[model samples]
Target: MTAAVAQSLSSLLQRTTIEDHEAVLKSCNAVLAKSKSDTRAQHVKAVALLKLDRYEDCLRVFEDAGDALKQSAGLEYAYALYKCGKPEDAITIVSQLGAGRGAQHLEAQAAYRAERFHRTAEIYEDLREEHVSMSNEENDLRINSWAADAQLQWKGQSDSVHHTKATRDDLEAFETAFNAACLSLAKGEFGQAEILLTRAKELCRTSEDLTAEDKEAELVPILVQQLYVLNKQGKQAEAQALLEEISISNISDLSTKKITQNNVILTQQTSPNPYVLYKALNASPTPVDNDKLFEFQNNILVGNTHTADLLVRKYDGIIRSTSKALSQSPCPSVSPSVNLLAVYNAAAHAQGQTGALALKAICPLLERRPKDLGLALTAVQLYASTGNTTAAIHTLEAFLRGLEESISEDDKDARFNPGLLSVLVSLYKREGRTAHIRSELAKAAAHWRDRSEPCISLLQAAGTSLLHSSDRADLEMAGTLFRSLHQRQADDLFATAGYVASQAVINYASIENQVDQLPSVSDLVADVDVDALEQTGILPSPGSVAAAAAVIAGARGKRPAAPGDEKSAKRVRKSRLPKEYDPAKTPDPERWLPLRDRSTYRPKGRKGKQRAADRMQGGVVSEKVEEVATTVKSSGGGGGGGQKKKKKGKR
Candidate 1:
């Protein structure tokens, strides 16, 4: 290949090997343009297009790539074939290819898709060495899991072949049912999964039927999956009940245990307790660690509103449990320190509590840890959440005052500056002290911009507060803040929406007149009658005519004429014509009348059909037709009118 083509191919390879499938496709197209017969370019192009989900286009390229391309890019060609729903053909091609990693992987996939599980299992076993050598652990894990599934499926199919046994062995039966259930659940066949899992559960109940290893390895995993399915299906109550029946400790030990079965060292790194906390907010048999709880809370910050609510509930539960424990004992579990009580109260207050008790709890802590910024912020936030804005401001102000004093003495901690500025910005924003807000916000932007999550949050909150203000200047300030936020985090939809809304508000305020100079709905739609619209072919049916009429009526009622508009002047001036009459044009009552309400009318929904009917004999029939044809013709085609027969021309 020429150097230019080689360079192009190298560029294309880089794009294709990583993400950026779009760039790869573009680069490949450019490469293919210069060298139409370039096999490598065509192959990469096909791969790129496949990634972009242009499956049919990719298949077409493969089919047209001729014999040379096919020989060189057999794996890609096979993959394209497989993607376009020709797995059998793909398998044939892959079978002929050399034992390349890509070829073997595609072959296994094709076999799996074709339900040739035995073949898939064989290919996976053959590829195991190469798979183990690969650096991608995630991909390796996936391949291993797929191989196991295929083997299980193949074994289950083989077991069902025996007709002699009325029932299969319990362990085998459980394995088969569990595998089927997992497949069903993955495919979203919840009903089938539920049935299979119930059977597995029954088998599991007979403790003597399976060994301890089988129970640990097989049955427990299936139960966890069953729990997941139940949770996903919103059968929370059933999930909770089933969860109580299972020993979480057993599942934990099973996961933590690294067992060597055969040559494969099976390993799993998961603790079911944290997952339980996530799925069931009130259900965690093990003690929830504070770090784990906080981590869980932080992860769910960007989750859906329901998940966020769950996190809040979890936090509230922890706080309440901690508080209840603190109240019951003379000395707390670790220490009866004021800081601990303050932290607990802050947590409770954060979960939307009154924080009256929390405020009381934090007072002593504030006195003890006067220099602790966290304790002070906690008190401020607790006060804020509990509608004690004055006290919150006062607490934050006192902290700021102390920091200023330390700064005068050249002993101010730089770490405390950002936190103090953020708190002051929030408090000033809440109190509508715009000057203070701007000052503190400027300081925060200079110090902590993009360096801190809390700073970003502070900016967002302040922006939102200013956005709600009626003052144009405040809105402009808000727009500036939100625009900065949008630039920093382009994916922040809330920031983007706020910016757009602020821009709209600013634009609307820019107009000199309060009302829009829009053309009136009546004028735009200009005296259009529903009946006339139907007759003149503007509307296709009476239903469409009725819909148009409804829309026009709604518009006319909602948007009254603007005071500065011509319609308003006409409305104010009385005309010489009587109320019921128009002198310039006669009004048609039928055309102007509102459409009849279709809802109140009983619809002729079903018509009885005639089973037996007489054939006409010279315009006379012994028996009449019991049912007439009720299918309606198009009203536009001169409704049921027979076409006039053309007179024969006299020759």
Candidate 2:
């Protein structure tokens, strides 16, 4: 053992100890390059190559190392060969490693990786049975973990295997099912994954030593996967329902009496399942017990649900105790999250049961903490559902004002603002405040044009309000707004077109009084189809008397007479006559003269008096009366003989 030889031996031992194969390989290669005849260095280099995942290089290095320790290095060579897809060669080498448990395990892993699942299972079973009496429990657990991992991998790789058997109580079975479910999920086989996960959950349910953390880790994955599966199946309502159930179960179990208070807070702080908190807050059997809260928080954090119902009862008791404790020595200051959590729980429970008083009780708490976005949102929702638009709007405005002041330019709050904007629009609509509604819509559109929900909703609100507005300018503004929005949101075409048509009607009305100032009827008609007008039931039918009157009145620029006017009254009565009755064809107009004297026709009412005074003020009225008498005498020819006989009698 000279200095250089001793250094070489030490270097070889250090290379073998290095976990990183590439580093080991590099170091071993350096040693091999310096000592070409060192067979031991060559063997170490081959093992390094094997670990580095370069199987062919490992084989070359092993062959060049010579046959001095081939039996001992054979297992490593076989594994490297197996990984390189040379399973036949791996099998031949592994078969010669003798009947040791380590050899069997290696062979099993190789068979599992090669897709020979049944053979791998047999090997693992034999290893387990042989190692049952072994004192190394940790080794057994590791072997079981490996076998389960392999089984899960196998199940995932092949879907043709029937999985009807109930999962065994062994941890290995659950591990296999979990891994298989995960693999199936990754491959978009949600149905198979869900079944496997459900089985895994059933297996873990009865495990006595399962800790809160373990339960949490175990169940969270399954629930998340279940959610994914249910959502993919288009069973959204069912998924939501399942989420609710899981939340309730988690809260009940975690809040058991046995859970420590510190553990409760820790669990509440770190738990990924917020739904449990949500459920606990909303659970029935009012006035949440402290014990129940404690248990709920614990179980939720831990993922235990074996005795959820009992835990829920215990939770009720704990809540009562905690409330008494808090009352005895009230903390003057609590974290905002804690207060908000309390309010959230209360509000959620109130909302679930339609407990209006309970909801109102939490409002002050929520109002005081407007910074809590979740609390604010839930409050708005609950108020809105109850038709308390005022309260809802107030809560929403508080949130918006807070956000506007606090949210920064780089914050992600911009993505969430549109939803709040939509809620504002809904509130205004519910209040029938068209002006506020339009303003909110415009603001929303400016901010949320890319978000289809808010954009479409705002456009609809604006278009509807504009359609019903009397102002031409407003209608035109609405039309322009709708047209711009329509390009982006084609689904709102019907509403957009209605707004445009409304603007057209307003334009038509404006021009009605100044026919010369407006486009001609034909031109206007060309721009707007009469059929559309008819379909909308806004314009009268073509050629109808009403239509004629509209056109005549429109053309003359004369306002139609009021109904109380004598001439308008007469026209209205005459207009009601059948088409066959022609006033122009009357033989003697005076033959149907009034039986009473002209004094009888004297004005009686204020309107009639005004008409007579105007007639008297105008000399044409007296001349028209004389003309009517002279025309009547000319029509009476028999009057001439009566006049001649009267003249003879006088002579």
Candidate 3:
């Protein structure tokens, strides 16, 4: 029997088709029928039936499983019974199993769903005690979150006061208060909602466990709802005071998170407007919506504008006053569409006040969807308002520079139109960049030549400046530009002025040099010459005339001597030969003669002659001669044939 049951279970597990769901159920039922005591198989059948939405069949299986388990199946049985619409039966089952807080929470949820407010409150009170007793932080938080939800759902049904400390982990508590406040507002219980929302705000403020970011997230939606309720109740002053008290830091954090979590929470909730409005309100201080907020902020960026403050007050009043309506008896789930609309409205409101604020408000929306041209335009305009011309220009250029097809002409016209163009032109003018101004003017002229006002104004100003300037270059350039303009728009006033200036300049140039010379000439040559100076001549006597002619002839005939020739040409050259020449005592051609018989030259002195005689007597005539020759050569002259022969041999 057990083998058959196991096989059937395995087969059931393998079944996939919806048609097979019944077969799977039948197999499990067969196993249970044969054993009539297999709780596990019965439980399996119950789960299978539940999957098929056979709630009645599943409930019967769970009951039989419970009987077989004899107390083992506690929470599972209770859940199955609850799903079968037997909350009381589920509650009894949980009690029998001693399921504790989980059971109570489930029972409370069932009671709340059934509109048994008193029972729900009672269960929540017990659950709250269970949460306080538990030491595990995660478990405590989980149970407390449910407890808060229950208490909020049944706020007037029980007399139990909340005992949990307003610690940072009181997120669930704040959520509870937020819901209760919303509910009270829905039920026309404005005062009660106000109290709960105010408590929620206080808890958010004091909770140490709540991060600044988390606190902000908790505060904004509650505050916005409270503001709506207050507004609906005609408590303008109160609403304004509450809004004024809201920390901008908190708002900023909430706004940032909302952008990322957009539509997720609101899509599941009943009232998204309050939450979205909260996000927008928080984002109001950013620099993005300055232009959008022009009317509200009075075009001032630094100081607070009374008008904007008042607008904020009015909006806050409206929000607080409507909070009650949003939080009616049974809280409705928030729809995605309502959330989206609320975001749009908030962004619009922020834009209406200041472009900077509007940008911050819309950034989240844009992040969710970059193709929203309205948001793109708003961002661009805000950038312009903040004097971010480069950013604005780039944004426009990006839109114009297509990654795909260009934006249609009609769409461009619809978007940029005349008003936007005017704004762009004005911005360019304000920046005082001539090139940008010119480009923008030209663009405008090309697109809207029929209007002509802006183009005409720019042209007139440019022409006037050119005409009045002292720089002729400037005038010339302007004239050329004017001619171009005239070609585009004939007979334009500025163009006409340019043409007249050009002509006047030409005429002035022609007469200018002559006119300027007359004064200087008058200063230097006053009363001087008429025809007398022109006919003046110099006459000379006959002698003077002849002298002048002679001088001229002399100058023509004379030529300058070459360099170094004047001194050297007058110097006489002496003959190189000595005064005495003796051919009989001829020296060899390659040799030099001694200074003997020459002026101041005698045959060598007595001592030299004695030495010569001794050398000859020794039969050393050649030697004596050679010695003399060496002496002479050492003195820088050839000695004679003997010396010559010796030199030749050495070489």
Which candidate leads in lDDT? 1
Per-residue lDDT over 1-651 for candidate 3, one digit per residue giving the tens place of the 0 to 100 score: 787866675565556454566777887767766676666666666667767867676666655555655365666666766766566677677667655666676776556444455566566565655545545644444444444443443343222334332344443466656655655564567777788788888877888888877876667776666766776677866766766645434444433333222222222234535544444334443433111221112122212222233334555543343233323422111222222233334443464566567667755654553433444556676788888887776765554343113355544333334444455556566667556545444444445334433345454445544555556665665565565666766646546556556546656664343343233546668787644543342222353754455445445674334456654354444565456755478754534555552344434688876665654545545566679888767767444544544345654
Worst 10 residues of 3 by lDDT: 289-298
Lowest summed-lDDT stretch of 10 residues in model 1?
A: 258-267
Question: Candidate 3: global Cα-lDDT?
Answer: 0.53
272 Cα displacement, candidate 2 (Å): 23
Model 1 misses residue 565 by how many Å?
26
Candidate 1: list runs displaced more than 4 Å: 1-236, 252-342, 345-361, 381-386, 400-436, 450-651
Candidate 3 has a TM-score of 0.25
Candidate 1: tens digits of C-alpha lDDT, residues 1-651? 676876667565655555688887887787777778777778878878878878789878977888887888778778878877678999999989967777777887777666566666666666664545466533453434343453443334332121111134322455555655665664567877788778877766565866876766556666666776776687766876765545544544322121111001101213444443354432233222111111222222213222323344666655565457445643212221433443554555445444777667567766765655556777887789888788898997776666656544222433335445666767776888887665555444444444534356667766776766678877787777777787777677667766765667678564323123333567768776866665454434454655566555455574444447765454434565557665478655466444332323333333311111122234433233322322332334464566576789987
Q: What is the clash count of model 2?
A: 21
The global C-alpha lDDT for each of the candidates, from Candidate 1 onward, is 0.58, 0.56, 0.53
Clashes of each: 0, 21, 49
